[model samples]
Target chain A: MKISLFATCLSDAFFPRVSEAMARLLARYGIRLTFPEGQTCCGQPAFNSGYWVEAKEAARRLIDAFRDSDYVIAPSGSCISMIHHHYPALFRDDPAELRMARELAEKSYEFSQFLVGVLGVSDVGARFPHRVTYHPSCHGSRLLGVKDEPLTLLSHVRDLDFVPLPFAEDCCGFGGTFAVKMADISAAMVTEKADHVRETEAEVLVGLDMGCLMNIGGRMRHRGQAVRVMHLAELLYEGVRMADERA
Target chain B: MSGHNPTSTLAERVRIALNNDFLRNAVRFTTERLRTNKQAAAEQIGNWEEWRERGRQIRLHTIAHLDYYLAQFAENLRRAGGYVHFASTAEEAVAITLQIMAAKQAKSVVKSKSMVSEEVHINQALEEQGIETVETDLGEYIIQLAGETPSHIIIPAIHKNKAQVAELFSEVAGEPLPADTAVLAAFARSKLRGKFLEADIGMTGCNFAIAESGSIVLFSNEGNARMVSTVPRTQITMMGMERILPSWEDLEVMATLLPRSATGQKLTVYMSAINGPRRTADGDGPDELHVIIIDNGRSRQLGDPEFQEVLNCIRCGACLNACPVYRHIGGHAYGWVYSGPIGAVLTPVLNEEKEKWAEVANASTLCGACYEACPVKIPLHDMLVYIRRRNVEEGRTKRTERLGMKTYKVAVSSHRFYQLALKLGRIGQKPLVRDGQIPTRLGPLKGWNNVRTAPALAERSFRESWQALERELQQEMAEMSPQVKARLEELAGKRGDRHEQ
Candidate 1:
């Protein structure tokens, strides 16, 4: 019943409301939550940029910080994927650290995966009236196999109309540092993604990962569109707040 | 329009590709068609994953014992009255090709679609020697007239639209031709048929070389490969050393995967397997056949752990169709004979010039679509990471980016430093923040803000709000009914048990 939050660095600094929403939603489900202050970035930027040694430094720090938690969950799919899939590979040379990394990976879960898979709660008795579309982040949908969990949960939300995003599985081009390193290609990909979002004609775009939302939402803002972007956690929390007010 | 000049920086070539709306539309249309076909074909072939795994295993086994299989292939080929020549480098391959051409007194040579010939610059080399070399494949012939290398592997003239093709073919025909597919095809067929009949040597690239039978296989939709291998009195097949299959049974797996992945066909129009030169009783076959096995830079990857699996590639170009970057920039921006995700990894690795081709590697988003699309399951995305790592280690990365990454590494490893940096960033963006986004192209945001705005930093860090949220959560949990709490706890316990198991 106890969960430790792994608020990714992006969420921690730029999208704090996502973590706040996650906390509120988990509490409504009668779950106990703790924040591990020592938690930092998941080393994805370094790891993805081919800086293995630097990534290992951050990985070891994360592993040590969450070494005692029974369940460590992150709001971001990409960071969780880095821990669950990449950590063991990072520590392959050292058996002790490798074992610890594997153990940590086993216990870590992406936020939506934790909600639908672990908690077995699809509808939290909440209502959302706006038309919404979902963008499945590449790491979450493909890498972590968190494909249907988010969609299934959204489908169960009371009064929420879910429109399927066209080319939903394609990446939003927030490839960590790739957004800057190959900005031109990244812009093109995000442009196409924004076009897809417009085609859906959804009022709000929801995704589990903040990195993707930031890129897509930023593009939407740049084009001066009125489409609102919300993290899945924020939407779920909004539902909980609405239900609580009615009660 | 020979392929984009290799000397131009990738950025320059990308600029060119971006500006050419026609090229972008052509590449996108062709790749989208190919991708849709491949998806449909994959669905038609049930248990696609199993088929892919089988293909990967076959390629892996062959590449693992490449030496033994290649030797067996050479022996079997020689036994079939074929001459085998080994070329360790591109220059050596060109030299061997020219030597055979001279020995046969070959004046006009016809070539089927061959990437290796492109790699070796064989057309230029042969033309330099006053030998007429005609590309027989329709796409190749179009690009050949354009004086450009292939942009896509399967569709070599992928960047050319029907109008462009008509223009290219018209120039070769000495008359204006309509922008009709049928007209272009007819023109190419008539012109190539003459060249195929008059040419003394026919040069083709091997798709898969059956080791046991010592037969080289060619898969083509246009049937040009058959002509290149049959009509000419002398035949030459250029093969990468890694293109080996242990037996015909293994070829079945490749046969299933290659066509489906390349163009989503159940089979290429022609899948020709030639054992050797024409036997005395054989009809409509070359009198003399020569097989050239070129290592070039492939041998450098034989024992390499990170890259050995790259040799397993079937060159299906599924990765190209699946890549977003390639879809935008086309193949020319790769600034090499090969382009797309495979080209991003292969161009640097094959050339062994990591520094020169580092920009090509950087061009990718590392999205792993290429890995997903690969029939042989080559970890091209991972190899790209390794390539980027090599670039960084070799100091091929930009100095500013290197310093930035170093600073990022330092800042992100600790929560305290990460928090401090965010606080600073929030304050530093006061002048830049407009309507909740940073829209100015300044400093590090120049490239990004040019096309898209970046989100302004949050006023409050999550860490600052967690304490209050945790307090509220504790109160809410305490107020929950006992029965509801027990049920949730029990459900959580069961889920945990299942996960542990």
Candidate 2:
């Protein structure tokens, strides 16, 4: 399919490889991938921070950027939810803005949602011999209503042992600006999440969003923990393609 | 800043809380333990979501027909010889309560944990009237002794460590006490049991007031709620207007959801449904039962679309456990009776000063974990945004923010202005850029970048890079497999239709 990638500002600056891996994997599935450059952010920071006007402006830019795309797929569940669920509310009183928001919401999909729902492929003939646990990002699990798609795909991976992380649905406290704004509380929350990870005795931890993975990964690093964090896309991209083709 | 001010900003109060290193640590330990227990319990339940949904539906139904259920509840309570009073405001509620205290000639009172009482600052009012009021809930008692408000709903003294608690208890015991849960609990039980027995009045918060039976339900892990309800000659129950459920059938769903969501228990140590004061035939119940239903600004949201669902909250503290904001700063930072996602919405919506409470809404990532954790399925994230929108709509945002938004609104409405702004931004950000990241923690970026650097604008924006790659793919496809190209078009067409549909 002609997939317009909203690499999300986080991926653009820090995790470009997640964006690259997504492109290659979808391309291998014979999908035409396009990038719409007019995008900057989904305007979540402003929106979440009570800056409605700034958020509306950002949302307008995002909608305009992907207006012509066949499918607007974002790697982050939180941001995609912002577009799909919240953007419409931002323009609740204005029919024109509301209409534009509805279109964007219809087009937007999280990376995993796009892969599992739109593409309808649970198995990519991938193999990974390791024990891993998954942390379902709050937005994806609750807001976006993606409960088992990621698990459905993961369970199909060959030779992989999936140990369920206790308190897997509990937030790891990477609340965008919330980490810094409430540093002590955030640190404590992540500590509990880290403990849960340790309890699982899994060598690998996988999640959908890089923001959460980064926060949990950073804390894991601080504690000198050996558990490695990987995005679900990277795992699927691993054995689905030849070594050199994998991002 | 306003009438009867507490002599400190909410931020200042939180600062005091934060400085108490002991408080911070204790809160961390308690919340961590509670969160873990909740997870384990949910895991054991298996069909946790279904139960949550059923719980949510019951609440939704009850709240939707609140007037009908409340009337039924009050009628049933009255029929059972319970006196039911509805207070339209905090002042009216306090007046009614004080009137009852006077009529009973109450000298001493014992209380169970009640967020509604906290909202009314009932103890402060009672103390001013020369009445000795004792908080019986272990956590509430600790905070009451410390002369501080509760920092958490479930664990009121969650902010105090064992040593601090021992110190507080020692002062009352006239001797040194050990910093042990068992020892402290025993001391508290002994001390509070006397107060419960001697007190003229017993006060408790109603978790749910069943409409059909005219009963007030209390879900407590500790037995104090029951003790307070049974021992005193007179029982006074305080409940928010939203605390109504239609029937005992719905109570089954609530019984399932409340304990599991709150502390992840299959059942609390005690879940009592008191129909009225002690019956003529019953031996150990309160002789006189009085229920005070307080609106206290809750009635303002009765028919409002954006906020009506907030009334469905069961005070289970599940949202607080799931909230990233509360997970970080704890409850005091919220600066109000409620905290976490529910608090963020409630503090402002319920408070008269919209400006003072508006900042609480900014404390979320809008990630919606609270919605997931909520047994009643309140869309707190969405409500947070609505609160923000109202702040802007009412012209409460700062001047700088207002101006910035004006410029943003103008620049983003069209591609022409947007392209110019982007080109300008790329050049403008150059001076602020350092080490492939925007290091300027100034203006709007201050709040975000205070802890993490803003990643610099990508060397090539994703949109720019994708266009170049797509162009290359188009040419390469002309020389590539036709079957693959056809499949690509077919899938793309299907996706497009889905988007349209």
Candidate 3:
């Protein structure tokens, strides 16, 4: 499968290794990944911040960039959800843009969703033995409906202890630009999430989206906690070796 | 009627609320508890999404044909020995309510948790007419005593902790009382029981009005709605015109969705369906029942494609729980009787005051959690965006903010402009940069940077880095595995076939 990887701007800049892991994992699944250079942001940051015109322009760039790709995959569920779900609505007035946007929306998938739903694989045979809890990103859970795929893959990891976090569905408060704009409220909300993570008795917290993980990780570091955070792709990639060795 | 306090804006009120530590803590605790309870109940229900869609369909159908259903409901209500009045404005609503008060020669009135009454400021109007009105809901009673408006829709005095409630209750009791829940509730129960029985008129909000049966349904855990409906000799119900459904089958969907969405309950302790005034054979219910259906600015939203769906809100605080903004600031920060996502949309649209409400829309993160949490699927985030867009279109935005957005639009629309802007930004931000961070204490950035320092632009842009990666990707795609490629082709074929169908 030829897949265009929209390694969301955030991951590309701050967490480049996540993209590296994503590329390797897709390759293992026999999916050839293409990085469409013309892609910028998913226009979510500006769009969410109420800069609709700017967001639309950015969306235009993105739509044109990967308009002909067989499949567009992103490691971040939130960003993938943005393109698949939000782009069509963002370009509702323009018929031409709307058509392309809808096509892109249909073709785009979150990494785990692509793996489990499209690839039809329950176990990518990833193994990470750390006790970890997952924070399902709000957009991915509710918008994208990537509910149990991440967790299902996580649960399959051999010898890994998966602890359930309390209020697992509650938002982690990293609402794109909302964190910078409403820091006080964001801090309070993330504090509650951090508290819940502390109570889960898990050594690490793993999430599908890097944005949420980064937000939670930053707070964890700020509070001087040693709990590690990693993306689901990285964990699944780790398990592939185990499955191969066992075979 | 109480005049608008020219001293403060909604933003100013929210500012005061944000500063009030006790109010914040109390509101947070109560909402969190209610949210938790709601979650547990939804889990217990088993097929929550199916139930949610059922509720959404009913609300959508009813609201789309609001005039037809409301007219049918009013006609049936009148036939059932009830008086129906239509109020086009809040003043009209108050006028009709006050006319009922005068006709009854009522000196005192008691109310349950009707948001319409608060919206109309009926209590202040009645008080101005030298008629005493009391709030019977315990939470509302406390806030009423405190001389304040309700901060939350469901839990009216959510901003007041038990200590604050005890203080307010003690003043009403003419004796000091403990902050214990049981003790406080007992005192309120006894105190309000007197008002319930003695008041000449009772008023309440309609949760949903059944069009087929001419009945009004209310859900309440505390039984105050029931008390307000049954106790007074004369009862008045204020309903939003859009609060109608086709039949009892739809009511079942509402019954399942409302309480569960609002407070995470399988059902409230009491769910009452009042058809009309008490019949000659009945032992209870009011002798004279009057329902004042208020449009107040809702009619303006009738044909509004971008906003009409907002009318489908069940006033379930699930949106509030799921709203990141509401969870932090609490309800009072909304600065109206209604708070949370619904409040942000409703306040401006209801009042037709875009200038004041434009700020309320800004309070949202537009995360769409409210839409997810909505049992009726109101699409509140989309509505919030629409409100902001309307605000901008109306030129209600501040000059600086408008100019900034215009500049942003220009720069982003053109590649040359965008690259130049980023370069200029990196250079322009040098003075503000202290330790590679833009610490601006001026402009709108002040509101943000006042709390947390902004991160400086990275050394290399992601757009720049993707070019090399793109070259590497083309080479890899050339050597793709045929097995996966075949699978992709099959899936594409299926999708194409489905589209053709």
Candidate 4:
């Protein structure tokens, strides 16, 4: 399977390791990966900040970048959701572009959804021994209905102890530009989320999207906590390496 | 406290709410309890989505043909010997209310928790005219005694704790009252009972007006609304024009959604449906009934596609309970009669002063939880976004934020610009980076870094390292086991064939 990676701008700029892990994990599964160099941002920050014209420009660029890919997958649920749910609405005024956007939306999938739903694979031959908890991103769980896919995949990992996150459905307050714009409210929310994470006493916090992890992890770091944050792809890749070494 | 002062910005009000630890805990506890009960009630009813859809359809059909339904309601009301008056503005509604009060020589009025009265400032208007007005609902009575506006819609005094309620009630009781719930409620019930008997006129907000029968429905737990509608000789009901439902059958859906969403009850303790005033043979009901249908900016949304659904709201407060921002800041931060997610949209749309009310729209995370929690399925999150976009198009946004968004747009549209900007950011962030996190509160990072540290930019971006990684991957894939490679190729070929079919 040829999968075009939509490494979100955040992953590309701040967390390149996430994209690397995604590539390694997919390659281990015998899926060839391609990167469309023309991709940049998903235009969520602009669109969510009420800059429709600017968001449209970014959307058009992304639409053009992955026009030919048979399958487009992204490690970030938020960016993938921006394409799968919001892109068609953005291009409603242009008929040809709207049709293309709709088609692209049908083929685009978040990382776990692509792995679990499209590939029909749950156990990716990975192993992990530490306790872990998953934070379901708002877009992933609510918008894209990617509920249980990440959990299903995680539950299959050998020796992985999964604890449920309390109040897991609540947003982490990393609402694109909302974090900076409404910093006070965002801080209060992330503080509550961090508290929940601490209650679970999970050594590592895993999430499908990097934006939420970055926000929660950054807060956890500032509070001088030792809990580590890892993307699901990175965790899965690490598990695969562990399994491979044990073999 | 009586109404939104409009003197402070939404940010300033939010800061005040944030600083109040007691208010935060009170709001959080009450909202959490309400949210849990609502979830259980929804589950108990089974097929909640179907009920929600039916409620949405009923509201859409009524609001779309509001003219016909409202006319039918007025005709039926008049046939029942009730007077229906149309008020186009707040002042007009107040004037109509005062006229009815004067004709009946009403000196004292008892109100039963009407948001429309708050919207029109009827109590203030009446008080200024030397008429005594009292709030009958326990929560409203507490806030009224404290001279504060309602913070939450369903629970008017949601920001007040038991201790605060005791203090407020003590002032009214002319004695120190204990903070016990039973003591406070008893004090209020007894005090309001006296006012209900002495008041010459009763005023209540219409929850849902049944168009076919011309009956006005009021949903309350305390039965004070029933008292207000029955004890006075003359009655006045203030209704937003969009509150009409076509028939009692439609009321079934609203009845299912409203109470469950508001208080999580199977039904409000008292669901009173009164048609006009008391007939000649009736006992313990109002002698004269007057219904005032107030437009008050609601007509502006009649044909508006973006905000017309906002009227479908049943004032359930489910959105408020579900909103994280509201849980933190409480209802006072919204600085209006309506608060929470609904207030974020309704305040701006219902008020003609968009320049000021538009600030309310900025007080949301656009998390869409409110949309998920809505009983009528009003797309409140989408409406909030539209409100923000309208504000920006109207040039109401801050210049700094506007310029920042523009720069972001230009940088994010091109990979070259985006990578260069990231590279620049990496260099610029060096002085601020400590332990792989930016901890300095400076410039744009001040607000963010104040509460949470930011991750430092990667030492090498993905794009810069991609070519080398690609070469390494090519070498690794070339040495892969033939069996695995053949199996993957065959699977890809099968997927391609399936796609072609």
Checking candidate 3 for backbone clashes, the offending pairs are A125-A239, A126-A239, A127-A239, B38-B264
Q: Model 4, range B418-439, lDDT digits (tens) per residue?
A: 8889889988988878877788
- Quote the lDDT for A149 in model 1: 89
User: Given the true complex, what DockQ would model 3 score?
Assistant: 0.31
Q: Least accurate stretch of 10 residues (summed lDDT) in model 3 chain B?
A: B1-10
- Candidate 4 runs further than 4 Å off: B475-501
| Top-DockQ candidate index | 1
Q: What's model 1's overall lDDT?
A: 0.87
lDDT per model vs. reference = 0.87, 0.79, 0.79, 0.87
Sort order, TM-score high to low = 1, 4, 3, 2
Tens digits of lDDT, candidate 1, B347-427: 999996677788788777677789889998998887888887777777787888778778877786777887788878888
Model 2: per-residue Cα lDDT at residue B65? 85
Q: Which pairs clash in the backbone of model 4?
A: B1-B149
How do the residues A66-114 of candidate 4 rate in per-residue lDDT, one tens digit apiece? 8878688899888888887778767878999897787678678899988
Candidate with more favorable, higher TM-score: 1 or 2: 1
**Candidate 2, residues B389-471: lDDT per residue as tens digits?**
78878887678767766776666556457556656777878888787667566876664454445555556644446666666
